[model samples]
Target chain A: MTTTAPARPAAGRSRRPSGRRAARWPAWRAFLLLTLPMVAGLFVFKYVAIGWGFLLSFNDARGTIALGDWNGLDNYRRLLGDPAFTRSLVTILLFTLFIVPVTFALSLGLAVLVNRLRRGRALFRTTFFIPAAVSYVVGALVWKMSLFSGTPSGVANSLAYLLGHDDAIGWVAAVDPPLYWIVLVTVRLWLQTGFYMILFLAGIQQIPAQLYEAARVDGAESEGRLFRHITWPMLRNTSVAVVLLLIINAFQAFDEFYNILASNLSGLGRADGRTPLIYLFQTALGEQNYGAGSAGAFVVTMLIVVFTLLQGRFAGFGRTAEEEG
Target chain B: MRRRHLGSYVAVIVFAVPFLLPFYLLIRNALMSKRELGSLDWHWWPETISFQGFADAFGNDAVPLAHALWNSALIATISAPLSTLLASMAGYALARIPVAASKPVFFFIIATMMVPGAATFIPTFVVVGSLGGVNTLWGLIVPGLFSAFAVLLFRGFYLRFPRELEDAGRVDGLGHLGLYGRLALPNSGALFASLGILSFIEHWNAFLWPLVIGQDPEFWTVQVALSTNLNQQAVNLPALFAGALVAILPLVALFLIAQRWIVRGVLLTGIKG
Candidate 1:
């Protein structure tokens, strides 16, 4: 997929000059016409908004989103000083750290297992990948209310009862031991792991069958050995991409967190599983503190950028196909 | 080998149950009465099916669940096709045109894909708000139309488009516009279908942006409506589950129909990235 990009249209370009004399006006016009709305919308909605947000982060623009009230880092300082914002950052960092590796391993393992199946591979793949299409909000609600609800009738409580655990545990509300992590982690793992597994499955399928055959002929009798020497090495690019995507998706963890923890009568939880996006949502929208909210946004953005760049550095993400070859 | 196959089957089923169980419970509970749902004994299957929950959810007084469904459907239907069209156009320009700025433009759009959505969250709200977009469906629909990911996908597809087809168009004196409109667009139905389905599902399931923009209950999308039900004390559990079922049914159906294309799109994303 990456390599096909730069193979470019030298053949098309050769014909381009001949057509250029006749088609110059139309080509330029078509290009502009085709690209203008998208470019303009992107510029206004993304670039301009980002610039405006950067400016707003330096202002005291609370209760309003308008600019011109300069506060000179007060918003940043305020957020950095506030424990809730900092705690939310810590919460997300820990969530990412916990979720990324576990998800990576689980997805990779599932991919290997599913890929090796000689029959019903498509059925299992569909069964697993269907959840990827389910909305996180719906998934979270299902998890929180039905699967892990605090009531005795909830699925987890029923299982617990059957196992002789008498108490109906408040999975989302549990704070002292942070049992909420179980709920948070499980829900996210369920929602996302399949998608990544599919990614790994595709990566695995891309490996040449001859590689495995050759490894087998070389007296690599065990499946594990064949996997370790051939499949694992061949899947490096995919593994890197999966990890990168997982980290980004983890850092942007709001939907499940918000739906499970905050989208109830109890309101946003008392510092348990409150991610940066949730915190910023509360700040900017709930309290009308746009300045501090924007500041927090940048802080999280920087965190995401740092993590991505670090991963890219290690993974060599942006290197040209020639460079990799 | 038979034992190994059995073991594999067991492992796959065991791993799959957690993923499948939620949907099972969701559907089961959605069809049960409140009394049935709250009973101490779990009913794995509904002893008697009831549509009371669906009825309640649709007729809920505080939040307009039906309206929310309509809003969600409308927004998704409009946004998906429009966004796919715009992205395809931009992608065609970037892929085919010899314009000097295509490289930078393509990269710039791709770079936007990495901009953590949170960074854009507040400012986009502000921008959209300034455009008198708050409380309007246009606000929700317009910004989402510019998807960097879709642009990249279309660009990737266009880059690999058979040049012979366009060469034929050129010989027929079809200009760039004619070629794209006549030949390229018709030929790229699969790409359009895949991207359009993805965009539709995305917009359908969208919550945060819709919640922020559609503060009015009249404009609440299905996700926002379901979330509102979650927060309310009077909201019935069975009804909530029913509401969720209503919201997810279309998307699940869409996925089943377009499963091949969607899966292919996902694999392509992995490969290209």
Candidate 2:
């Protein structure tokens, strides 16, 4: 799964192009023809942007993206110094820390449960996966407007009323309990848990049934025992990959947070829910502070890469690459 | 080995509710009148189904729901095929071509994936803005199509492609492009379908890039327009729900129709970074 790319083709392949003029020229031409468009576009759009943004981060490009005003680490220093930016960083860090483990457990549990069902498996899978197809903006709209709306008539509020808590809580507004986390977390769970569940289900399905049968025969009568020994261990790769993706995604969370907590034109509505991307968004686009924005983007990217590398090291995520290579 | 577990059934039903809740509320409120939406009455259903919400949503001048949907469709249609072609070609080349630089190229593309898009977004925006791509459909479509993830997937698919087929195609006088177009591309329907669906759904649901690129109302994708509508002062609640319904239903329908390929595409995520 990690390294299927071959360094060279097989012996009899004409594409190897034995010292023939026409064959070699056409082969090179085809390689360029095939890969040039996408590689060039990526080089320009991604690599060039990264280079320009790196240079831009050091300069005071406020209200301007032009590069001559070299400030030399001022942008990075200012961002780290500003409470809002630092707070956003802390906020995203906390989000990634919390959301990754919770989502992992829930999705894994859902996958196990769903996989056990002989009846209505597709029905359950479709129901769970449907939200994955939904746009975050729409999901946030529904969650914000109907489910978590501050009004007493809202579903959550109404449910609370039935439970004898008569107060119509402002789920997205209350900072005392930081109830906005509830809206943000629940919406993400609803929207994303199912997708991860699918990945786990695929992983679970890949384990041979004979292993479970053999386990059942070897005094592993209980489902929990079977899962602990066979299912969990067999799912090591999937679990690690899922955890890695969850961390990256948790760090990159902007859409639902922006949609539910932000009042787009007014910017991020509260300090409580501001993630790094939203902060960078407001900085770069809203304030036209491209310098700070570029700097923050670099910081966030470094954070993600650091976490990924850490996971790769401790979790042995890229171990398969070595084997296959 | 297939056992009937009551707990699994119970848990699935319980878990399915939270996932289904938002969709239910979205549709329910989208049908209800503004009065019914605000009512304190504990009615399980809207008093009466109404298209007025949809009417008001599509009717809203500032957000322009109908036009936005059209723009999104156009962007998705163009971006999907274009990305699939380019990504599939690049991916296949990285997989099959014995070019000396292929391994370096693959690492470069994958490295691009490691950096979050937002980090490089401002400069990307600057490039496009300088190229006069802002407020144009191409502004959103062109830049967004160059996904390294997509290239990675195609490369993975082609790595497993049998050498015998290409060997046979060589005997037929087909060059590499000719072989890809005629021999490889035609047979890999599953990959094409999966990649095509992946690209389309991505373009349709994309928010940040579309928002940054399509500043004018004329170019607003559905997500951008819905976002603008939600943030507007004095938002019409029912109309917003209606707009959301209009926005998500196409994808929902598409998902149900193409669940097989979409899930296959998603499962491909486990292949690698």
Fnat, model by model in order, equals 0.62, 0.69
How far out, in Å, is residue B57 in model 1?
Answer: 0.5
lDDT of candidate 1 at residue A186, scale 0 to 100: 87
* Candidate 1: stretches off by over 4 Å: A1-22, A263-268, A317-325
Best by DockQ: 2
For B74-193, candidate 1 gives per-residue lDDT tens digits of 999999899999999998888888665666677778878868774568888878887899999899899899988878888878878998998899899998888889988888899898
On residues B77-148, what C-alpha lDDT tens digit does candidate 2 reach at each position? 998888888988998888877766677788878878877776567778867876789898778888988888
Q: Give chain B TM-scores in order.
A: 0.94, 0.94
Instruction: Give the range of the ten consecutive residues with the poorest summed lDDT in model 2 chain B.
Output: B1-10
Local distance difference test scores for all models: 0.84, 0.84
| DockQ-based class of model 1 | medium
